[model samples]
Target: MGQGRLPARLGLACCLLLLLLGGSGGLGSRGMPRGPWEEEQGPVAEGGPWGRARYEAVKKHLRAVGALSKQYWQYLACKVWQEGCEEEEEEEEEKESSPSPGLEADLNEQLHGQHLAKEVVVRAVQGFLQSPQPQKALVLSFHGWSGTGKNFVARMLASHLYRHGLKSKCVRVFISLFHFPYHKYVDSYKAQLKKQISETVQLCKQSLFIFDEAEKLHFSLLDAIKPFMGRYDNKGQVDYRRSIFLFLSNLGGNTINEVALDFWRAGRAREEISMEFLEQRLRLELLEPAENSYAHSHLLEENLIDFFVPFLPLEYHHVKLCARDAFLARGLPYTEAALDEVARMMVFVPKEEKLFSAQGCKSVSQRINYFLP
Candidate 1:
């Protein structure tokens, strides 16, 4: 009985030992638990530490793939929308840049008296439109007496160059007396002026800046614009080359008329009076100081202006032409007698000679009503 009991106990111990060995080395080819029940149930059980870690790693990988796919689709959608938006913006810009048919005809018909002035304006505008990347700003200085079509030509240019005409967002007109009244505060004014110009040019590369009554502006104020008007080696923050700067003043009116009158007295045709003659004399007059004149300004001394376009004084025939156009604009009867009467109403200078229109059809609109009614 004792021997049989001993064998049973020994057998029981051996069974226990075998069970421990099998539990320790029951790994599959991939080092996971291996058994029919374990394979079916999976290595990661719901409550165990190893089970939770394995489950979380699989979830994180799936989440990463989903995020990547979402980002890819969003990028593709944004690219498609951006391309369409860019095409629309380009088309709109092209349409705005083009000139209107009526604008061309009006400019040709309304801007009379000075044939050279018309040619210069037309050529400059054409050049500006045709250029893809201008190296310098188009700085045009219109010098003439009152009502000699200086302002009229500028208005016509603004109308043709921009879609909304003078009211366009890219067009900025600064009057000397109105915009910059405090000449005593030169430093503050200069800083403000530069800031406005820099900001405007940054916003729109093809901007138009009109300086009206420029002669009345301080000489220092005009000098502030020298850098923008001239060419530069480094273009800096804003490329002002594509912009247009127009200065309208009565600075060289007398010089222009004297040249014209001299040519007339010499019995030479108006066409013979070359631009070289006008430019040289005008430059001299502008550089020399005179009472109530812009001659002292560095703008002339530095020769920063690209074109010094002279609006020649209007003759009797030119005023008559202006009257006829005004009548037509008002939808009134066009009569030769009415046109002649309008021309006769204007006050001409040099009573002895009575050569050209002193007012240059400036009061034509007002005088037209006198003849019409």
Candidate 2:
């Protein structure tokens, strides 16, 4: 018999039902609100011509960001609205008057541009949550040496998404430090890593997997994710959209000299260091084949990792460039002098050889603070 056609109303009802029943267990009790990160009182200006311009820019960016948030909510509602169960109306009505939970410090005004990267990360995360693909993308972020952006990004992203109407049911965001190379107990690292991936895969189809200090993941674990990184499907339909893997490494570790020296000392003869090691390890671990090399041979040559696909490493320059565009879209402008300064700043500088490390969004933000007013 042919499948029964669902009426428009019935279809919307079903969507709601699936949303409520499919992932309700994980829905945060506090629930998500709309416009998670739109600045209150809109965008503020410090005053004067420069300040006024900056204010306008901030407002423009805020509007762009806000629009994206609204689009996301509507998209989600449309997807689940049709499938909504009978009780959805009642549940929504109950929530209508409910005051939102208290704001997080990061969500508050003080932090502002300090959290740009977090904002980018969260939006990407929300995108993954609403994705149609079965396997979500994983994000891996690496902070500056001994830097604190690890938990900050995770917490901020979650809070930001929550404000935009994505509860735990729709999105799962986790960020943790690197405890590898030395764990209190044997197999603890691997076990926890594997369990986290499993949970992410089960809870949300489009997973956002991140490794803060991706470079620090164990060699064995690195070897395991190559197969899982690219598009694949059990039924052989070639599905690559399921997962998002982000590795936020300082591509040029501590100092070029130091990084090169370490590689040099290891007898890993190469004039330049490449993020390729991390990439190769991912392919070996997750992908089925590597240039048709033997399984043992590939494993022997590759590094062992504790987890699969610990954030595919992208150059700091590339990340910053992308972030700059994102920031500009949000209404921030770079004056000629400012642009020149940014171009120079974006260049990679070793810790020792450099007085500055174009700290991507953070650095640009500081520059804005100084130049704006």
Candidate 3:
């Protein structure tokens, strides 16, 4: 409130305060009421300086409070009441919002996302959806280290199906998340998975079986579904012929060696790897020693390639191509050069089959975006 030029010491103090305020991460602490929105209202109807600030502050606070509240509720319902609280409110909510016992809705909801392998995924999903009645549907999705768009794409593909009139209640997608140490009932594992499928068949009368990050589940589980991988009649009690099976995997190919070599050249030896080694690693990570033989034998015998399969051979390429088209269709700024580079990187190379796996499309796109300069 004093005149700025009245005292040299006071003036110097003001200058110092301004300098401190201008420094990095200095002005936004809790005690400071000033904010970026302190000058005007946002795009919302009630817009003003203090009003916008208050509104934004309220929203931020509400979001934080909401997250805390959610954690509190989860604790109360799962951790707390799971210890045996029979409260009526929790009971009512349980009835209203609890996931379906068969987990059809839960699984379908999880699968609804922008699946990276859009073409193959879309085709497989559509076949599953359009099957006359009681068709078995299967999807297998995999992701790379520090990569999540693969899962997001899976979700989007599922959303597309729903928008086109696919009902969640009628579809069952089994998605496996990250690998965790869990006891495998070797003898009953297949039976258990089949039982879940059987229950879905009985309840929905038709089902879409999905495996998310399938590489993480016991190999026995993958082997168990071999019979239903291709177009076929429902093996379950239900008479459904339109069942679909699909796998989306992020497993690297021989190009992983190149990536590893590049890393080594750049002085990061820890990441060197090969496709065969990766597949073997994934196999070991998922299946117990006892179950390995059964799973490996079944996979080879059934002919379900570790890669996406389409009604036609060339169609496999469509997975990556169609995804690029979709990205451009959605205004993601895909240029011809980009497309050509992707195709060249993925298809043109004679040894591509042995070199790069799905990462040729996904990992390459990511690196292209990151190192544009």
Q: Going through the candidates in order, what is the number of backbone clashes in each?
A: 0, 57, 31
Model 1, stretches more than 4 Å misplaced? 1-94, 99-106, 291-293
Arrange candidates by TM-score, highest first: which order?
1, 3, 2
Could you give candidate 3's per-residue lDDT for residues 1-373 as a string of tens digits?
Answer: 2465447644554565444333322244454444344434455635433555566865775576556655545544454235334354345423332222322333333322222233344444555455555323353434343232454444554444433222354345555543322536644767777776666555443345556555556666666756555445544455434444445443432332334335445775332333344445444443443433324445544544433321111112433564465555456766666655554554322253442233333454453453244
- Lowest summed-lDDT stretch of 10 residues in model 3? 307-316
lDDT ranking, high to low: 1, 3, 2
List runs of model 2 lying over 4 Å from the truth.
1-181, 223-241, 248-334, 341-362
Worst 10 residues of 2 by lDDT: 304-313
Q: After aligning candidate 2 to the native by TM-score, how far in Å is the CA of 178 from where it should be? A: 4.5
Model 1: per-residue lDDT, tens digit, 273-353?
Answer: 778778888888887767653666666667678788988888888898998888888889978888888898889876877
Candidate 2 lDDT by residue in tens digits, 1-373: 1245336646665565444333312334355332322223333322323445546765775676566655545555555454334355445434432223332444443222223333444445445555656352343433232222443455444444333333444343333343565634426766666666665554444444555445445544544445455334566433334555544444332333244346545876433445444444334343344222223323324332212212112234433453455357558765555555554655444444442234434445444444454
Best by lDDT: 1
lDDT scores in order: 0.77, 0.42, 0.44
What TM-score against the true fold does each predicted structure earn?
Answer: 0.72, 0.34, 0.37
- Per-prediction RMSD in angstroms? 22.6, 19.7, 18.5
Number of clashing residue pairs, candidate 2 = 57
